[model samples]
Target chain A: MTWVYAVTLLILLISLIVGVWRVIQGPRLADRLLAAQLFGTTGVAVLLLLAELQSLPAARDTALVLALLAMLAAVAFVSRVWKVRPDSEDRP
Target chain B: MNLLIDFTLLIGILAIALTCLISRSLFRSVVFFILLGLMLAIGWIRLGAPDIALAEAAIGAGITGVLLLDTLGHLKKTGNLENDEPAPGRKRLILAIVSSFTLVGLLLWAVFNQPTPAINIHLLVTEAMPESGVSHPITAVLLNFRSYDTLLEVGVLVLAVLVGLALQTDQQAQDSLPGLPNPLLHACLTLLIPAMLITSMYLLWAGADRPGGAFQAGAMLAAAFILLHISGIKLSSQVSHRMMQAGLLLGFGVFLAVATSSLIGGRPLLTYPEGGAGMLILLIELALTLSIGLILLSLFTIANSPPHHKDQGGDHGH
Candidate 1:
């Protein structure tokens, strides 16, 4: 069980590194933002794994909060980008 | 294996921070900055500090991302974003790299040289936990052992919103993005908002025995309100300024009232009567959750607002 958790966290860490690489070579603003979103998801997974491995329930709570707020950046991105574009329909 | 994980995270965090600093595009850099916050949240969890991790994920990564993205949007609109992001010349880039490495070296040196003989606060916190208002050590510390600090922390949040609102009042009203009128989004909110609210309230109430607390709960609530706003729910307009003001003050007001009432009881300020500390702390936490939520929502809304042309005739809300 401990080894399984370690492997899971290892995979997450590798994925995070890959995501940061994507951010560095962003072809567009959206791509960079997507990498950040990936981080948020991966982070929750990693937190959950650690929570189990360390027997600390607080890490699970942090994961829950992370999962809950994950959409905020994406939502803010869409709203602000569209609003500033000067062409959003008035939700008719 | 643990060491390897820590080393990898360390490298990843450092690389992301450097990338955020030197990324040629301001927008890209801000996105990287948000990513940095996310990575830092993970690091905090690894260090066994879930309270800090929750705050980092919520406020550090989530809210900061919103504010930075909004600022980038404004800069893009004014054409300042592109103009100000001229690529660094080779010499300047090298200088920046050198200086950053030196700073990192200094930090590493300090870490390695730090003495470890200081009293262990973990033990102190644990020793006091049963007597403190909350069973959770961090909660007890924040609201009971060092409650005056918590009171001031809430005050600082209040002051920040007021200052931000003051700076925002006469500013140009930026175009609000139309919350897309889609049944899916509406349906999602119907389910999601309730869950978010329930979780936030549970977090507040469970704080006595768990890792959650008013600040995390408040931040979650604020995120919920922002989510609602983005989904075409016009909560800000429905809530009159007077009402908003009342909501903003509710947390601070309740805290101050509790503190003063204790004073009237002939105890020192903020000292609850015997066996009443738990209930008092819970009450303060409840009001604080509401006020903090409103303050954060207000900041979110104000940041999204457009800069008004100084010559345009606009009515200030203040």
Candidate 2:
């Protein structure tokens, strides 16, 4: 059971690495923002794993906070950076 | 295997930090910086501090990310951000490299070579918990054992909001008109906002026994408010500037009232009577939660206001 949690955590960390790679190689701002969203999701998963592995339930709340606030960055992007490209909106 | 995970996290943190610094576009860098904050939050969790983790995720990443993105937008609007800042000359580059290396070396040495503490405050806190107001050592410490520190911390937040208000020239008084009418997004927020409210209240109450507290609850409330703002629900001048000012000072005022009231009973300032400490702490926390939320919401609202408002209108600053 412990190994299962560890392996799951390892996979999440790998996903986080891949996410960072995408952010760095981002050809568009949206791509970077999406990659960041991926990190938030992955980070939450990792926190859940850590909570299980360490037998600490308070960390669960951290996961909850992450799950909730992850979209904040996206909402911010849409609010301020939403360009008036009705035609190019489908590019993503 | 555990050490392997820890080491990998360290590497990830370093990689993300470097990317945030090296990225060409300011906006992309800010995005990466949020990722770095999440990684750092995870790091804090591994170190067995969920309180810090909660704070990092909520305030460090969530609120700060919004502020940074807003700043980037402002800079772009004013034609200040170049896609690429010019490369540093060799002389400056070499100087940067040397200074960074020296700083890194000094930090590494300091972290590994620090002497052991003469006393473990953790043990002392747990030992004193029975006498303090609460079962949770952190709550006890912050509100009972060292109430002054917490009081001053809340004061600092109030001061920050006051400074933000003073600097708020209202040049950008345009309340953000929603970019597009998305009923779907509105529906989602309608569901999410209630949940956020419940969670915030839960956090405010849970501080007595768990890792949640006024700061976390207040920040979550502020997030909900900001989200609502983005969805076109203005915090409007309907909240009247005077009423808003009172809300900004609500926590400090409550704290001062409670702390001074205790002094009349022949106790020192902020010293709760033997059995009433818990109840008083809860009362103070409830008020602090409100003030903190209002202060944060006001800061966000002020930042979004137009720079100049000769003819004040809806959503204009005081």
Candidate 3:
């Protein structure tokens, strides 16, 4: 079970790292936002895995928090897009 | 057997991640990212963290996807601004790959090499499990044993909302105006909303017996609200009254109230007095779920609000 959890965590970590690369290399803000969302998803996965590995009870709570935070971040990013340019084509 | 499942899920997650990063269309990337969230949720479940799985499904896949799509709409409006830039050349891509692998290698090493903490949390949980009315060690630890962390976690959420409010200037009311709320959409909401409510309630009430609690319930409620918002049921600022704010703070408020009363009853802060903890936790979860839903919906609605008041008078105000 621990081994399964460890491998899952490892895969998630890789996903996050790749997502981070996308964030840095993003030619546009929208791409970066997408990448950021991936990062948060991976973070939640990591927390869940940790909860299992350590037998910690807060893994779910932490994951929940991460989800909410990710939503907020995504919303904020979207709003910024709306704010910066009213049209769908403005580049920042 | 477990290892096989883990490897398969890992491959699936990797594929999703690759598509999310490499996809050219913004819409496609958004969809893939949501899929990635789903896969990650399954990974959590496979790892034996059902609570985390619930959270990841509701918050990670559901709400985050909505937010991303909304942002994508904005990006489309912005026109191909970023796409104008050249995609990374081969040399840069190769360098990025090398560096990312190195970072991963280092992280893996750290994970494997870190000396285990001296304290045996498992032993502590086992020893203290008898004292907790709750059977699930994680729930007991979260709410009964190390509830301080939980309290602070709630506090962090409140603080984030406050910061969001403060940062948001010229907030326009994103109230749902009379538009064709599609019958299908309404139908889905009717079914899903009630079901979600029941599940949220169950999560809170069952925290003592199973892998559910306030945080899970709260996120679930938030997911329902997200659905409503996307379907055009907006969260109006005019309705964010003192009661609404109180509801938002209900989790922290109820927990504090209970914890303080415990002192007078001769127990420490947050120490549930025997069987009472389960009920108290339920009450907290219920309140938290409602507030969390409202909070999340409000934040997203406000964020998606057009800058000018006239700009948001109706559906997709131009």
Candidate 4:
């Protein structure tokens, strides 16, 4: 079971690395923003895995908070930053 | 396997932080900064500090990211987002590198050369836990044992909000950015906001027994408020101005009153009376939670509002 958690976490970390690449190689701001969203999801998964792996119940609470707040950055990005410049939708 | 996981996390955190620092685009930098925070939360968990991890999740990943994105929006609105400032001079770069290396070296040296303490603070805390009025050691330490520090910390939060308020000339300065009137966002807020509020209360309640506490819960509450504000439900307008102000100060006022109440009993400041510690700590935490929520929201709204100089100029012209 611990190995299962470790393997899942490794896979998630790999996905996060790939997401970082997209963020870095972004031809568009949307791509980077999407990558950030990916990180939020991946972070929640990682936290949950850690909670199970370590038997730390509090880590579950952290995961819950992370899951709840994950969309906030996207909401802020779309409403406040992205929508401000309709013309620069693809601008990096 | 554990070593591998920790190693990967360490490398990942450092790499992300470096990328965030060096990213040429401000937007990319901000995005990477958020990523760094997410990674750091995991790192905190790996280090076995769930309390810090929770704070990092709420404040570092959530509130700070939104604040940065909001600032970027302001910069974009002012047509300053693409302004390419010159990079630092070579001499300055060298200074920065040297200083950073020196700091790292000092930290490593300190880590390598730790002196044994004469007294085990953990032992003291364990012995004192029964009387501290909380099952959670962190809470006990924060609200009961070292409550003076908590009191001052709340004072600092209040002071920060007051400063932001002072900077605004008009009490009712309108936010320049209109609420996002997306139908889907509004629909989602129906579910999300309540969950956030419930979670906020849960975190507060959990603090007495677990890793959750006032600051993390306050940040959660602030996130909910910001979500509503952005989604077209302006809390500032819904509530009376006087009521809003009182809400912002309620925590600090309650905390101060409680701290001073101890003085009346000839106890030193912030020391709870015998057998009353639990109630007092809870009362203080309850007030602190609300005040913290409002203070954080006020900071956001204050930043969201456009500068008052333009409004003042228009008034002068009229």
Best of the candidates, DockQ = 1
lDDT of each: 0.80, 0.81, 0.66, 0.86
Q: Work out how many backbone clashes candidate 3 has.
A: 11
* lDDT string, candidate 2, B183-264, tens digits: 7877888789998888889888888989888888888888888777665577764577778788878888988899899889
| DockQ computed for model 4 against the true two-chain complex using alpha carbons | 0.51
Please give the lDDT score at residue A69 for candidate 4: 93
Candidate 2, residue B60: the lDDT equals 80
Tens digits of per-residue lDDT for model 4, B219-278: 999999988876658997789988999999999899999999889989898888888898
iRMS of each prediction: 3.8, 5.4, 9.8, 5.1
- Measured with C-alpha atoms, the lDDT of residue B300 in candidate 1 is 61
Of the true interface contacts, the fraction found in model 1 is 0.68
How well is each residue in B1-318 modelled by candidate 1, as lDDT tens digits?
888889988998888888888677777777888888888988998898888888888888887787777666555554345535557789988998899899989999999999886998888888977778678888888888889999998999889988887787545554355565668778888888888899899889878887788998998898899888766686767888789899999999999999889878889987778888898999999999999989988876776555456623432221
**With candidate 2 superimposed using the best TM-score fit, by how many Å does residue A56's alpha carbon deviate from the native?**
0.9
Native contact share for candidate 2? 0.58
lDDT of 3 by residue, B139-246 (tens): 888878888888888778888877876766654544322222356656766776776667667667667777777777777777666655655565443465676677
Model 3 per-residue lDDT at B250: 76
Candidate 3 lDDT for residue B295: 74
Candidate number of the best lDDT: 4
Model 1: lDDT of residue A19: 83
Please give the range of 10 consecutive residues that has the lowest summed lDDT in model 2 chain B. B309-318
The 10-residue segment of model 4 chain B with minimum total lDDT is B309-318
